[model samples]
Target chain A: MTMIQIRDVNKRYDDGFHALKNINLEFRQGEMTVLIGPSGCGKSTTMRLVNRLVSPTSGTVEIGGRDIRSIDPVELRRSIGYVIQSVGLFPHMTIGRNVAVVPRLKRWDADKTARRVDELLDMVGLKPDLYRDRYPSELSGGQQQRVGVVRALAADPDIILMDEPFSALDPLSREQLQEDVARLQQELHKTIVFVTHDMDEALKIADRIVLMKDGEVVQSDTPDRMLRRPANDFVRTFIGQKRLEAGGAADVAEREAGPDLGGFVMADGPTVNDVMVTQPAVTYPGRGLAEAITTMERRKVDSLYVVDRQRKLLGSVSIYNVMDSYGDEDKTVADVMMPVRYSVQSGTPLTQAVELLASHRLHNVAVIDEDSRFIGLITRGSVVRHLAEKLPHGDNGEEPGSSTGLGPQGGNREEHS
Target chain B: MSAGLSFFEFLGERLPDLLLALREHLTLSLIAVLIGSAISLPLGVLLVYSRIGWLNSAVFFLANLLQTIPSLALLAILIPLMGIGARPAVLALLLYSIMPVLRNTYEGFRSVDPHVLEAARGLGYSAAQRLLRVQLPLAVPYIMSGIRLTTVYVISWATLATLVGAGGLGQLIVSGMGVNQPYLIVAGALGAIALALAADLLLGWLESALGRRFGLRGGAAA
Candidate 1:
């Protein structure tokens, strides 16, 4: 079913801010689409338009084939589940009562209200017996967010709007909540429009990521394609900006690849990210051990980049982690993979082969610089030998440092702290 | 003048030694104000919470009617039935004090969130339960304001009972003025002011404490 469709939706505030211009997009049923952009982007305003919290200055918003303008706003809002950073809980009501709000307003009978509240709390992993009667003030931030989600789910709405629902939480809590949302999506299957300024967050939960800026959409595509290629330079700039610190690069991998990355990024020259698959797609550590074996067979590639949702490159999964974590359901992605090694720069001299092998125990390193934005990889067997035959090893032929700038020692660290 | 302290002493001595007269005056003030508040609180809640046309109209009518009449004039109209003494005085005080309490009470209840009430509505609370469970608890601050205003008015009007032969502090003022003793008249006036001020402070404290207890629903704004 076409859950929501926007065609040339342009909103210009009376104050003369072009909040959104010529917006066109379609959201299908039971899919998770993330809208991401910089701070002043119209993503938040766009989501608010769906619920009519903020009306479009000049555009038609249709929900399930009905122009939202024709339907009563109160009724429309009631039919859709809305969640924001604050959660907007009624402070006076009990946890159970809050979750039961929409259903009760819609007049779900007594026994049914009780049953729905009970099931929802449980689905969100909050035991009804422990939390149903407690007040919003009594819960923690993550728990409050969970209840907020439960409240939206109470009516079993076909569409859900979530705006930075986890940004306020700590990293561990955010990961936990994201997992909860992923679990919920699998079970209830609501068509969700999630908004966030963080690209890593978009990669984690989005089936399709829609990049927005200045109230206009720049690109919309799946995580795999977005990483493999980017539609434009602005997206490419955001594609690999560090998040959590120099941890493992799992999350950054998805981000490092742009929305345009469906094919390979060939660095023979400077090609825009949209034209090629710049970097290889990284698999998650927790994915079945069978993933490594299957990807190897399907893509006919010997290795796959391993990453977390942030798009940071954790490390590459070769025949290595598959053999190690094989039969170990208990084994995580981090457990079997080596820390990042065999990395290089995009501009290493075509020489120094003998020195490269002796210094870094790896066959290759990247031939790139600090930004790592468009660095080309250099194989020890290729570039070093070429450079050795021609230039002198002294002051010039590629700065004497390891081919992989930081060396195979610690090349690609985590983006976030 | 003993900073005007002697005025009080002089008036206290001049008033009659009749214990029954003083007690009757105080009793009349209490009875009238109490009855008035009892009727107003419920009526105010209904007007604000239920949005019932008759209830709101009744509140508006009583408040406007009482404010228009002079206190002494209103009492005269009741003089035919209860024959002077405490009866007419009590009726006059009750009628005069109702408007403020009624208006504030109604406002307090009406201002609560429709969403909070919707939660109650969703929970399947009966009409009466919705009022008791949601509106009343949140309306306490406004209700308290009405109560405070009624207390201040009733205390001042207690002396008006003297005109009906109920014999309160006003009896001393009347006697002192006739004999040319300004001290007795001043004393009675000072006592009424002190009583009103005290009632106002006590109720204000009570309302604050009540607000603290029910502050969970964005209470500072309440």
Candidate 2:
């Protein structure tokens, strides 16, 4: 269902600057539509037009099939949730009161408003009892932003307009909040129209990305389609494919494996978990050199990572070193094995994992959990395969099969070469 | 002294007259401030939001000019039109006190954080609602400061009412000076000073109380 419909919108400011030129768009219910562009690209102006913050110079904005201008602007805004870059939590009001503003304005009963405030604060991961009476100044930036989101959602408004809500936060807080928003959207499925200039943010959270430039939309498509099939040079340059390839490959590849992964892309780069091969060839420390070499040959890997009976990593014995003691049945693999210094946590981002491998000039690294138990191995070949799948070959020529089988392979790693 | 008494003796002897005069003096100041606040506050609010920039400036200029006129001269000037009594004296003081209340009211409403105002507007507050809930509350400190200044100024200047035949503490001073009685003059001067100080302290307390109620930074600075 169409939640918001903007038709033939044109906005000309008092200074004669054209802020929006014939914008025509429809935002669907239960989907997060992100309006993204460089500064002064009319994305903000477009968002403002929906809520009547800036009435279009010559067009109509409709929500739920009724023209927005026909409704009282004040009433329209009261029923539509709004969040800004500043978070805009009323500094003078306590968190509970701030979240209860709309409810109070709507004349809700005291008990109901109190219950709703608590419900919203809890929904956003803030303990209501702890944060309810605190002022906005008392909370940190991330906490304030969380309250800001809850305040917007307090009234259960059908359409929410967010204007760079997380831009002011630190990178770590921003990532965590982006996840929170994604998670919240999954549970609530409210129609959200978000305005942001950060491409990665748009790609992470948007169900449909509306790319704008110079007061007009250049392209509006899913993130996968936008990445693979840019409409023009402007969009291609704006997305910066070359810049992405140089440093943002893991981020691109992480999403590449699941184009339809709905909300925020979790990892900044692909994690070791994303590329690691579970059930890597292993040999017991008590095994002979020939026995270890035979297992390596069967798995077609160059080395055998030796483990104790509990599967904790002890060391690794490569085929090259095992050959020196080929005929010695008395010598166990542990005697020939070299201590493995290069290991990464399963959650370590693939970029850092690659760095560790490259610096040590190693072909593979053991993937371990916090308990030092070996789970898998991340190989250079797997990294290359993941990245190659994201590279644009031509317009709309995406290899749809490449990542189809990559989805949560379920307790076993099948050889796909 | 004319009555054959010391300054303290004169104060004791004229205690009844002094009390009557002090009451009249306070009555005149309070009436003038009340009238001035009632008239100027709404006008100040209207002027700030109104688009008639020239009219606002002209009204402000006239009030500023009124404030600069010598208080006695203005009371004297009003004497002919309104008769020489408390009526003309109150009128003059009202004119004198208008500017501070008006100017500060304008400044208070104007100085409300634009972002806060924007948030209010965006959240669908009507013009009246915004003024009453957001602007008025935030402007309390400034408005109270303005009223405090006006009250103190009016109380001190009420002595000039004697020139218009409106008897106050100034009667003793005028009569004492006429007969060259220094003690009576000292008594009157002290009474007026004490009244001014008392009024100032009282208004200051009110201002801070209002500030604290509105949560405007504990109200001390304002």
The top-ranked prediction according to DockQ is 2
RMSD of each: 14.5, 13.7
Tens digits of per-residue lDDT, candidate 2, A1-417, equal 998999999998899999999999999999999999988999988998878999999989989899987899889888988888888777666889889988888888999999999999998889988999877778999999998888888889998989899988865467678889999999999999999877667767889999999999999987766765678778866665422422334544555467653322222445777666666778898998877766764554456788998899998887767888887879999899888888898799877776776566566778999889998776654454343333443333433333423211111111111
In candidate 2, list every pair of residues with a backbone clash. Answer: none
Quantify all predictions' global Cα lDDT against the true fold: 0.66, 0.78
Backbone clashes per model, in order? 60, 0
Question: lDDT: which candidate is best?
Answer: 2
Worst lDDT window (10 residues) for model 2 chain A? A408-417
**Alpha carbon lDDT at A12, candidate 1:** 88
DockQ of 2: 0.31
Taking the tens digit of each residue's C-alpha lDDT, what string does model 1 give over B98-149?
7877787778777777745643432334568667756787677777778788
Task: Assess every candidate by TM-score.
Answer: 0.55, 0.75
